[model samples]
Structure formats: structure tokens, C-alpha cells
Target chain A: MNAIGVDVGGTKIAAAVVSPEGEILNEVRYPTQAIPPNRLVRTIADTITEAKGDFEVGGACVAAPGFVSSAENKVIFAPNLHEIEDIRLDRELGSATGLRITVENDANAAAWGEFRFGAGREFDHQVFITLGTGVGGGVITHGVLLRGAQGAGGELGHVTIDPDGPRCGCGNHGCLEALASGTAIGRRAREVANERPRSALGRLAIDRQVLGEDVTRLASEGDEAALQVLDETGRWLGIGLAGFVNVFNPEVVAVGGGAARAGEFILEPARREVHLRARSPSRDLVRIKEATLGPASGVLGAAALARGEDGEYVLGPSKRVT
Target chain B: MNAIGVDVGGTKIAAAVVSPEGEILNEVRYPTQAIPPNRLVRTIADTITEAKGDFEVGGACVAAPGFVSSAENKVIFAPNLHEIEDIRLDRELGSATGLRITVENDANAAAWGEFRFGAGREFDHQVFITLGTGVGGGVITHGVLLRGAQGAGGELGHVTIDPDGPRCGCGNHGCLEALASGTAIGRRAREVANERPRSALGRLAIDRQVLGEDVTRLASEGDEAALQVLDETGRWLGIGLAGFVNVFNPEVVAVGGGAARAGEFILEPARREVHLRARSPSRDLVRIKEATLGPASGVLGAAALARGEDGEYVLGPSKRVT
Candidate 1:
């Protein structure tokens, strides 16, 4: 059996025709129209149609950025994608594509992808963290995704690192997302540049908006201020990861997202901190690794959901079109 | 059937005759002599002998303050009880008292007690933390203690809250135990008192041995320095709890131990921090409650273990007690 996976991001929609063994047979990509909810559903339908040309589609799964209510197949709240609030995305896309559709949060989808075919391949309990614009995570315990009581269990980024630090979008202070997230890193770099005008980072961003990439680039070039900023970000990441380690004690933690691309520069510090910070039993038992799917992780994860391997979508009411 | 429970602490050894329903029929207590390993086992046997006069003891469970090897039923490394390392306590006590004996880590016993008859009665998944001289915890998932691959699953107190704050016994810095445990609070209070010669806490600690009781006493009486110490401790507890919330997402967190007796002074701040710090899903789904058993919690938990209702200590060797 084959399935269609649609990854709905802020900029583009990517669709993949995936097999049971997690192999991708065919794929298609299209710009996600900056339009109304109905149009977005049409775009998803069109992308799925293009990807379904060479294989018989069993079911379609969409990985959306938001608080997805798996029970209702709706996007309850997506701060990054504000235009699709409360949209019955699965239903609308299913109606347009003439197939059954299952919708899930992107982070959950990525976790399933890792568990089934990537770094967490053989592990029954796993956690996946995506360190993109903000940190997002998904948890799997006993081979099942934990979607809490209200489909909001894996909000790992929101766990507080410092109570008096910067305010997060979730109305909290010193959250993992607010401390080590790409956005937070950029903000911190910009603040430091303004405070210390003599630093090289200050010279680079004289007029343009400072980004996390710029901070990483300067840190790589041996700027003490830039190195300090990355080190601080790594420390916060370690703090958040230590918390996750204590609670879940998962066998593996697969790290994805753009910030993680900095590799050992960020992860080495995080690993050291986690070892020093997490409870001994959990810290000693857990394995931390970079995500195998890279930028394609979310799409592969969404594909796994389409294949009915992802726990959330499988445990819910979604049907197969075969 | 009736059973005996022995709670072996650094200062005292408590034993109780417990019914199948987790009720204590008779209780006995004696000071724990800092003697040789064989003598310690003899003292435990003596306590069981004292309890057996009141009931027909079918089995006995002892909650020891260290790691107990499941394969050999031996005490591994009890730093607090250094004289008892590698001793086959269960076998020795069982032979001496003519009853089946089982040994478990004290924190695990407490968690089982809560799960069977205390605050965690209704939840299948729970995490119990006792904030005493050190932080100790036990995990129950699917009505079973989550003993890790190495029989060291729930060491919650050792999770780091601040990587740079203070040195911990486990050679780590800023552990939750080092920040919020009774020992940590007292140490912090003493440090502050030493720094400020005229502080109320300073005057109260004549010998500079600032115990947890003194800090709680002063904080309750509106002492500014003591309140600051408690508030800081609560914040660390909240941070660690928030991490647990994200990882385990247990239905309830039962807080026990000496420091917890401060009630709202400690619990309120921890609760507020959890609400402010944990992921929205965990905060909304999980309940944070103080231990209902109070000081007797350890003994009751130990009794529950003996009764085989706590699930950590079944009667036969085939069951591999958690």
C-alpha cells in the first residue's frame, strides 16, 4: 500500500508518495498560496493529486504547524499560520482530493518519522526536538505518541529555563523557546551588539536585521561575544533537554530544526550540560543524536502519518482510502 | 495475609504490621545504630520480630536508603549508610525473621504507597518526589514502577536546575537536590546568614548549623532572608517539576519529604512556577498535590510495598519487584 504525505509549512507545501518501509517513490512541491482557508485546502488537494500519479494513494496525512485537534481534524491555533485557525483541514482536503485524510501537529509527525525510519528506528520510547524558529518537540512512549488530554502533550519548547528571562509568545518567561530558539538567539545577538558597540557582530549588523545565522557565522569566526551568545543558548538548550531527560527517560532524543544545523558547536555544549544537569539514571540511559531527515524530516514524518504508522493519527478516527 | 514494612533511614528504623488493604495494625521504631553491615541487618531483623508479635507476617518489605540490586537482593551504594554496601539484607533478614523479605529503594516504596492508598490512588501513571535531605523520586506508569534498564529509573532530585549554582554529591553542579532539598535550603540559609551578620536567621543559628526547620520557622514568622531562601527553593522545585510535566505528563505529582511540610510556603510557589513554566498541556492535565501521608508517608509506603498492593514488591521471585 502507498500513501500521500503533505507538509503544510508557512511558505511551501511538499507532498510525497511513501511506501510502508518509509521509502519515498515520488514527490511534488508547490507554493502555499497566501489565500483563504478554502484555497489552502485546494492547494493541498492539488499537491496530493500530483504526487499520487504513480501510486495508488491509501490515505493522506497533513502535517500542519499549530495546535491540531486530532479528534476534529482541525487546526485550533497556529501562531505562524494565522490564516488557518479552526479550519477543518483534513475534511476540506479530503473532500477536495477525494480521499481520506489525517491531520497532525508537525512535531508529532517528525517524531513518528524518526521512530519508524530515522534515528529512533528500533526504540519504543523516543523524543524528537525541532530547533527551528522556535523549539518544538514530540514524545513517544511504549511506541505510542502521548497527545495528553487535549492534544497538547509535547509542547517541550514552552518548559521554563529561567523565570526572569525574556517573555515568550506563550506569555511565559525564560522558556526554552524564549532562551535558545533561533528567534531568541537572534534577539540576544542583536541586544549584545547594541550594548557592546566594539564587537565585530555589532559591525556586521549596522542596519540590517540580525538573524540566528549571523550569530552562528560570527561565532564560527571566533568572535568572543558571538561565542558567548551561542554558549549561553546551548546552556539553555541543555537545561530544557535535562528537564525532558528527567521526565521522559526516553531511549533516544533526535534533534532536528535549523538551529541544530550548527552541529557540535551547539550540540556539544548541550550534551555536556545535559550530562551535568539531568538526573543520573536518565542522563546515563539516554542517547542524543542529530535528526536523520534534516529539512525533509517533517515531510517524512507527515508521510509516516499517511502510512498509518504515526500513533496519533492511527489511534484517532482517520480512515484508509484503499 | 499480613506483612511487615521496615523504613530504614539514616537516623531511625521504623517497622509496621500492615494489612492487605494497606492499613497499619501496629508500628515500632528504634534508632538506627551506625554499626557494621551485619549489625544493621540484625537490627532490621529485630524490628521485624517486634512487629510479628502483633500479626501473622506473610512477607516483609524494607525500604532502604540506597540502590538495591534486583538480581542479588543486595544493597549497592547507600552513601548515607556506607556500612551496608553489597550486603544481602533481604536474605539475611528473611532467614533471621522466618518471613519472605524484599528490599527496594525508599523513593520507589513511597511512590508505591501513594499509588496504592495515598494521593496517586486513581492514576495509572504517576511521579512521586520527596524533597528531604536530598531529592528522591519514583515513577509509576501503567500501574507499574518504571525501573530503568539498570534499576535506577526515578532519581528525580538529581536533575539539575542550575548547571553553575552549586556542587552536588553526584559530582554535578546545580542539581534539583542541591537547590531545593532540605539540605540545600538549609545550606543556602546558612550561607546567607554568614554573609549578613545581623540577619534574624544568623542570630537563630548559634552554631551555624542552619537546619531546614529553622528556615521554615523563620520564613513562617515573616523573616525576609528566610522567605527569600524558600521562594528561591520553590522556584527551583517548580522548574524541575515543569520539566517532569513535559516528559512524563503524569496525571499527578505527589510531593512528600520534610521540606514539603512547610505547606503553601513551599507548595504554593512550586505550584505557581509549574503553572507558569510547564507546557500548557501538562499544566492543564496534571494535578500537583502535597503528600497526604505526611511524615508517616515513608512508613506507609513501605507497608504498602509489603502488602504487595504497591506493585513494586510482589510475593514471588518470578515477579522481579521494581
Candidate 2:
């Protein structure tokens, strides 16, 4: 059955009409409105309706950021978006569009998207790590997503890599999030530029704020200071990857998110570290690959969820697709 | 059906006739012979025979340390034992004892035992960490042991906790095993005693070689030096536990193995660190419990494996228990 997959990011909402074969037939994009919760739901409903145009949408899935309640289908806590607490988008949007709806964590949706249609398609067990503004992950074991008891099982970024390193947003010290995220990369670049004014990053900083993109650009352009920053960040990323490799022993690890676009400047060191640290059998078997779906992964995964592609949902109450 | 369970340790071979409800009807133990591969198999087979007694044992499971093959019933690599590479214990023992046999990793067996009959009985998702001579673990996700693609998934102890702390047997530095195992604790005790010659542990070390039991005993008796060692070790254990808690978010974490017998001396600090480090929701829900099954966990887990209690096997070809 054809379904609508909506990706609700902090600034924009992207929706697409997805076919049974994981292909997007049509799409719509709108800047997310941070008005009253009900209005936000209505706007999302309108977007889904527009995206569904000329075809009857059987179901829809909204992938949002933060702590989504498995039991209530509500957004419990969102760190990035404003005033979305306790928003029952699934029920509201379902009633508005006269269709069934499922709301999921954005990262989980993206990982599922990768597992079902991207780099993880051939692997039974896979882990998708996204180094976006923060480090987030999703685990698929034996062809099923592991959602734990609560819906919070795949909080990979919060795992402490260092007990006394930098503080993380999750109120913990030395989390992978604090060391390897795009935000972390930008923060480190700013710090290095401020400390060493003669550095390559400092030269870029004189024109404007040095963002993660600038660091990647400078490193690619043969800037030693930028290369050092990427090398350090990549090492930490590899350490975190090694931990995941040892724990899950997954067949494939798909690395995505905006920062991963830095390419081999970051991933090469990560691959080397994972090779150096992970144990024999898993180290020999596991493959680390770049995620292929790009910005469409979340929408594709949301569509998959709408289609009940995960076989069965283990979290809270779930409605099965006919 | 009655089944025999054999624990193939480096020093000893323990076997038992187990009832369907996990009761040990009869048990036997023998010093493991380390001459030839056939002799070792014969010793294990003989132990199973002695343990079966008058009961008709339908099948048996041998839990040994090292890498068990996914496709073939063989021990691929055993670090603790001498010259057991590529040994097909399952076939030889099956023929010798005239019963079907299954070979599993000792840690996996113990985790199964805990999940089926011990502390993890109520929880569907459980992670068992055995703080033995070397740290090892098992993962039960949705009530099935996560035996990865190649049956090496639950190598939790090899996760890098400290990058520069100590060397692990797995050829990595600062792995959780290097920092929290019974062997690590004993090494710490000896190092402390030798470094601080006038301290309580130093005085004990003067009498003889410091052991993990000696540290526990001294700590229980109010020795400041011994207490400090346990406190530090427990902190590291808690750090590793926090990582597992965040990654898997299992309902219960059962701490087993001989080193965990230190009781409150080690557990209190571990509990405290886990409380301070783990993210909310998971931190509030996860229970860190001392495994009740103790030394018998390995044998009982092997019995569970023989009964095919994991619902389905993700590793290799499995024989269903009828």
C-alpha cells in the first residue's frame, strides 16, 4: 500500500508519498511552524494531504526528534523543537487526514530507513550511527529493531567514552556526543582557532565563525590544524564505533548524518581505530559503510513504519497494517 | 526430557543431570585432563555419563570458554585452555555418550541460565555480565541470546572503557575486562600492597600473594586499603554497566562470576556510579542485581541451551528439542 512518510526536523518538515518498493513517488517540503501544538499538527496534516495528491494514502508516519512515548504516541520531550511536549501528532494527524498514523523518533526512523532500503539491506544485524548535531543510533538485531523495555534503548550518543572528558547535553561527562558530533566538531574548531591564532582554522575564523563545514573544507584543502581537529574527532568516533562493534558484533555499521559527509577525512581514522580495537571474528566480518539514502532516510523509514515493515512493534501499543 | 549439562573449564569439568524445570538431579566433577583432544572429549563424556546415573539423558550441552563455531559444532579458539583449536567436541562426545550434544560459550550459557531460572526470570530483555578471572558477558534481547552473525555478539567486556589504562588479554588497552575483572582486581591489590608497603593490603601481601578473595576478605574486615581497591574497581564496573545500560537499556543487569562475590564491597560503588552516569528513564528503570545462580550458572545455562530455551537460535544450524 502507498503511504506518506513525514520527517519533522527542527526547522523544516519533509513529506513524501512512498511506494511499496521503498521508492518516493512524490514529495513536499515546508518550513516547520512553531505555533500552538494543534496548529502544528494541522500544518503537518495539510503537508501530508498535499504530498498524497492524486493518490489515496493508506497510512502516514511522522518522524520527530526527542523522547517519544511508545505507550501514548505523544512527543514527551523535545530538546530541539519548542513547545511540543505531550503533542499527540499521530492521533491528531490521523483524524485530520482520515488515515492511520505512527509517530517515531527521527533517528530510529532514519536507521530503519537505512536498514530496510540503504546500506544495511543485505545484513541481518546492523547498527546505524548518525553524527548529526548529536550522536544518535539505532540497532537492528536478527532482522528486528531492539527498542528495549522503554523506547529509549538506542541512545548511543550518551554512552560515556571518557569519564572526565567534556560535559554532554544529557547531563553526563565525556559522552560520544560531546566528542564526535557536528556540533562538537564546530565547538572544537572554534576553541582551537581561539587558542592558536596562527592556525589554518584561525585564518578561516577571521572571516566569520568556523562551522563544522569550514573545518572539513580546510582539512580537505591541506590545513594541518583542521586535519588535526578531524583526526582527533575521528579517533573518538572510531572509539565509539569500536564499542558498538564489540557489543553488537553486527554485520554492517552504517555511518551517516551531516558531519559524515566530511568523508574519508573522518571515516578513515574511524575505520583504522575500529580495525585496531575490535576483536578478531567481528573485526574480520563487520563492514563499516557510508549511508546512501542521504536526507531521504528519515522519510523512507517513516514510510516503512507506516507500512509495518518492521514485522512487529515491540514498544507500547502498535497497530498492524492490513 | 532430562538433559545433561557439562561445564568445560580449564581446570575442571563439571556435569549434571538437569530436570526440565532447571533442577539438578545429579552432578559430578573431575579434574580436566589436558593431554590430547580425544582424551579431553572422553573425560567430558565420562563426566556426563557419571552424572546421568539412572536417568535417561536425551541430550547434553558443553559450555566452554572461547569461540564456538557458528556453522560447525566445534571450539575454534580457547585462550585459557591448551591446544583445543578446531576440536569437534560435540560430535565426539555425542558418539562417546550415545546422546545428542550442543556446544556453547560458557558466558552465553550462564546468561541463559540467569534468564531462564535466576534473576532475569521476569524480564524479557536482560544483559548478564560475568566478572570472572576475565570479564565476559551475554545478551538476551527479547528473551533470545544475541549470538550475532558469527556467534560473537556479546563480547561486552572488550568495550574500551579507558584508552590508556591497562592492557587486556584481547590485545587491547583499557578494555572493561582489563579494569574490572577478578584478575584485574587481584593485580591491583598486589600493585597497591607493593607500592604502599605500610598499608593494610601491603601487610596482607607480605604474608602471601594477594588474591581477589584476599581483597574481599580484607575489605569486609574494614581494611582501608582493601576498601579503596574495591571502590576503584567497582567504579570502573559501573562505568561499563552505564555504557551497556544506555546502549541496550535492558530491564535487568545481573552481575555474576566469582569476582562479583565481593558483595557490597564492590557492588555499592558500582550501583552508585551507574546511578550517577546512566541516562534518565533507563537509569530509573534498570536494576543492577547480584546474580543468584553463582558458580552453577554456567552448568545450568548449558542445560538451558540443551533444552533449546532461547526460542530460536540465530547462530549456525540448530537442532530443535522435541
Candidate 3:
């Protein structure tokens, strides 16, 4: 059997028909910005209906942003996707597509994707962290998603790491998201550029805004200032990872999102920090690596999370890949 | 069938035969300080045997302090109880008592106890934190104990709340334990006393050391310095609890151990801080409360964790309390 996964992201709405083995059979994308304001829900439904064209799909799930209530299958607070918030998604999409449709947090779906087929495929305990515009996280412990009482668990980005270090968009000080997200990386790049005006990163900042991508590019090209910015970001990331390692004791911590493209320049420093802070056995057993599925994780993970009408996983039990 | 639970602590070795309904049928205690060298194992076995007292016990579990490996049923490292470290407990204690005996981390056992019969009895997800000489924690999610890959999971105290605030016993700086434990409370009390020499805490510190208990006592007596110390401790505790609330989304966060005896003085400010720092839905849904079981939580939790020859919980699947 197959399932449809809808990634209702800020920039685009993508729906993919996926097989049990995590193979994508069909996919369609629509630019979210191009959708008329009142047509958001209709466009998403149409995209899913198109993606499911000829496939024998079991169910469908939409991976959206913000505070998602999994039980109610509703997006409570999606800052960018306000058009779809506060409505019972399963009912709306079910009526539209004639399929059992559900909603989930985008990061949680990505994490499930990683757990089902990516870096965490071999481990029962996995923590998936995404460093995009903000830090997002999902946790799988003992093979179950950790959705708290209101399905708002696994918000790893907002934890205080360096208590008084920096201010977070969440109105807290020193959150992991404040110091370690892609946004944080861009912010730190600018600060480093200002401090070392003679460096490549500083010179680039003089021309225009230095994004997280430019930092990775310049560091790969051996720019010392850019390398320092990434190293510092990795250190802060490690501080956050060390806590997760201690708490979840996951076997693999899959780091994804745009900033993770920094790769070893960021992960190596983060690993060093985990070794210094996390306890024995847990610190020794964990493997902190980049997420394998890339941008497609959202759709792939959502498909895996998709359930049949009888309330079972569309992919069934996860099997170990030799 | 009834099961026995042994609590091996720095101060005493106590064992109890507990019924399925969480009733203690028989109990025996031995002062650990009075045990002759190397007789620690013999004394512990004797305590369990004495506590059994002809009860129809199916199995027993020893709730020990240290890094307990649940897989091999071994105590890898016990800082305070070195005599029992690096030994297979199930085999040794099983042979000693002719019953299936297992080993578990003390705090994890306490959390289980709270989950089964105390503050968290009605909740499926609970985070139990003990603030003693140091901080210890255990978590239960979806009615299962969160023992990491090596039974070293649920180490909630080591998370960094204030990255540069203070040094921790684990050699990390600004861990939750470093800022919120009884030792941390005493340290803060001394600092506060020095800063306010006219207060009761300062006057008492001039004659003798002010313990966490003394601060509690003085605060209840309406002393300004003592109240300030507890308020500050609660705030740091809240900082750590806020992260747990976000990450675990537990229905209840139970505060236990000697430091928790301060009650509302330490808990009120912590609640205020949690309200300010934690995100909505999760923060709004969580209840931070004092643990009800007290010292008995150790033994009771161990009893609940006791596994039969079939490797099943002695209490069976949890049932809701009316």
C-alpha cells in the first residue's frame, strides 16, 4: 500500500505519494506565495488530490509548521500559515480528498523520516534536530514519538543553554535556538565580520548580508573568520546536544536543516562539546551526524507517519536494513 | 504475588516486602556506617532476606545509587557505594536470596514509585526530580520507564541551566544539579548570609553552618535572608524545570528529596519562573508539585520495578486510581 505526504511549508505546498519502503511514487509542488489568500486550504487539498492520482494510498498526513495538536489533528498556531490554523485538518482534508487525513508538526515528520530511513534507521532511540530559521526538534524514545499531554513535546529549541548569553525570539534568554539556529548562524556571521573586517566573511558582509550559506562556503574555502563563526555555533549546538544526550540517551542525533550543511565544520566542534559535557556510556554511544534525507525528509516522514483507516502505520513496523 | 525492594543508600540499607497494591508488609533496616568492610554485599543480602520474612515473594529489585546498567543487571559505578560497583547484582543477589533480583538506578526507582503510588499515579507521563545533596531525576512516558540504551537515561540533573553560573560534580559548569541541589542551596545561603549580615541566616551562619534544612526552618520563621535564599533556589530550579516541561511535556513534574522539604518557599518562585519561561499549552498543562511519598519512594518504586522470572512488572499493567 502507499500513502500521500503533504509538506505545507512557508514557501511551498508539496505532496508526495510514497511506497512502504520509503520510495516516492509521485510528487507535485505549488508555490505557497502564489496561492491566493483565501485559497490556501483549497490549493493544499488540490495538490494532495493530484499527488494521489493513480496510487492505491492508505492515508495522508500534512506536515505543517508551529504548535500542532496531534490528537485533534489541528494546527493551533502556525505563524506563517495562519490560513490553515485552528481548523480540524483531518475532517477538512478527509472531506476534500475522501481519505483519512491527519496533521503533524513539520519537524516531527522530518524526525520520523530520519528515524525510519536516514541516520537514525539503525537505532530505536533517536533525536532529530533541525537548524533552520529556528531550531526545531523531534524525539523517538523506545520507538514512540514523545508528544506530550497536549502533543507539544519535543520543543528542543527553546531550552536555556547559556542562561544569560543571548535573547531568543520566544522572549527567553540563551535558548539553543537563540545561539545555534541558522538565523543564529547568520547573526554570528555578521558579528564576526564586524570584529574581523579584513577577513573574507567581513569583506563579503561589506558587499551585502552574509547568510548562513555564505559562512559555510567561505569556511570551506579556508576563511578563518568564517570558520570561527561556525566553530562557535557548533560549540553552542554541542551545549544543547549534551543535554539531549543526557536526557534522551539516543543512539543517533540526526542534525538537519540548512545550517547543518556546515557539516564537519559544525559537527566536529559539537561532538567535542558533547564529549566534554555529556556523561559516560551515553556520550560514548551516541553518533551525532547530519540528517540523510535532506529537504525530502518532510514528505518522506509524513508518508511514514500516515496511517490506514483502521489506525495503523501505513509503513507497518520498521524493519532493520542490513 | 508480593515482591521485595531493597534500598542501598549511603546512610542505610533497608528492604521491604511490598504487596501488589503497594502496601509494605515487612521491612528491615541496617545502618550502612556500621557494616564492616567488604561485608556490604553480605549485609545487603541479609537485609533483603530478613525483610522477606516468609512472604510469598515472586522477585526483588535493589534500588542503588550510581550508574546502574539495566542490561547486564550491573552497577557500573557507584561513587558513594564503591563496594558494590562493577558487579553483577542479579546473579549475586539472586543466588543470595534464591529469588530473581535486579538492579536499578535509585532515582529511576523513586520516579517509578511516584508514578505507581504517589504524585504521578494518575498521569501517564511524569518527570520526577529529587533535590538532595545533588540532583537526581527519572522520567516515565507512556507508562514506561525511560532507561536509555544503557539504563543511564533520565539523567535530568546534568543539563546546563546556567552555562557559566557554577561548577558541577560531573566536572561540567552550571548544571541543574550545580544550581538547584541541597548543596547548591547551602552554597547560596552562605553567599546570601555574607551579603546580609543582619539577617537570621547571617547571624546563624556566624555561630554555625546553615544547612538546607536551616534555611527552610528560618524561612518558615519569617527571616528575610532565608526566604531570599529559597526564592533564588526555586528560580534556578524553575529554570531547569522549564526545559523539562518543554522537552517532556509531562502531565506532572514531581519534586522530591530533602531539599523539597522546603515546600512552597522553594516551589512558588519556581512555578512563577516556569510560567514566565516555558511555552504555552505545555506550561499551561503541566503541574509542578511536591512529591508525596517522601523517603519511602525509593523502596516502593523498587518494588514496582521488581521483575518476575518472566521479566514483567510485579504490579502488572497500571490501572487508573478512582
Top-DockQ structure, candidate number: 3
Task: Write model 3 residue lDDT over B1-322, tens digit each, in one string.
Answer: 8988889999999899999988989999999999999999889999998998788998999999888987788899988799999888898888999989889999999999999989999898999999999999999886778887778899999998876779999999989999999999999999999999999999999999889999999999999999999999999999999999999888999999999999999999999989978898889999999999999999999998888989887766663211
lDDT of 2 by residue, B150-188 (tens): 777799899888878799988888899999999999999
Answer with 1 or 2, whichever has the higher lDDT. Answer: 2
Q: Second chain TM-score per prediction?
A: 0.88, 0.91, 0.97
Q: For candidate 3, write residues A1-322 as lDDT tens digits.
A: 8989899988999999999888999999999999988898999899999999988999999999888987889999998899999999899889999989988989889999999988888888999999999999998887777777777889999898876778999888889999999999999999999999999999999999999999999999999999999999999999999999999888999999999999999999999999989999799999999999999999999998898889887877653211
Candidate 1 TM-score over all chains jointly: 0.79
Itemize residue pairs with steric clashes in candidate 3.
Answer: none
- For model 2, residues A1-322, the per-residue Cα lDDT tens digits are 6778889888888999887678899999988754456467677888998998887666788888877754467777777575556877767787788777777788888888898889987778889999988999888877667667776778889887888989998888888999999999999998888877888898888889889999999998888889888998999998888988988888899999999988888988998989988998888898887899998999988887773434332121221110
Docking class of 2: medium
Go through the candidates in order and give each one's DockQ: 0.24, 0.53, 0.57
lDDT of 1 by residue, B1-322 (tens): 7767788888898998877677889988888765555487787788889877957767777888766654456677776776667878766876898877777778888887787778887776677999887898987754556554344557787765665668987677777888889999989898878766577887876666888999989888988888888888887898888877765667889999999977778888888888877765568788888878765666666665653434344322211111
Give the i-RMS of model 2 in Å.
3.6
> Candidate 1 lDDT, tens digit per residue, A1-322?
6777778888888899887677888988987655556576677788899898867767888888877877677788876676566878766777787767877888888887887778887776677898888888897765666555456668788776665778988777777899888898899888888877678888876878888888888888888777777888887888778766765667888888888876677778888888877765578889888988876767777776763434334323221110
The fraction of correct interface contacts reproduced by each prediction comes to 0.27, 0.70, 0.67
Residue A40's lDDT within candidate 3 is 89
Ranking by lDDT: 3, 2, 1
**Position A201, candidate 3: lDDT:** 97
How many steric overlaps are in each model, in order?
0, 0, 0
lDDT head-to-head 1 vs 3, winner: 3
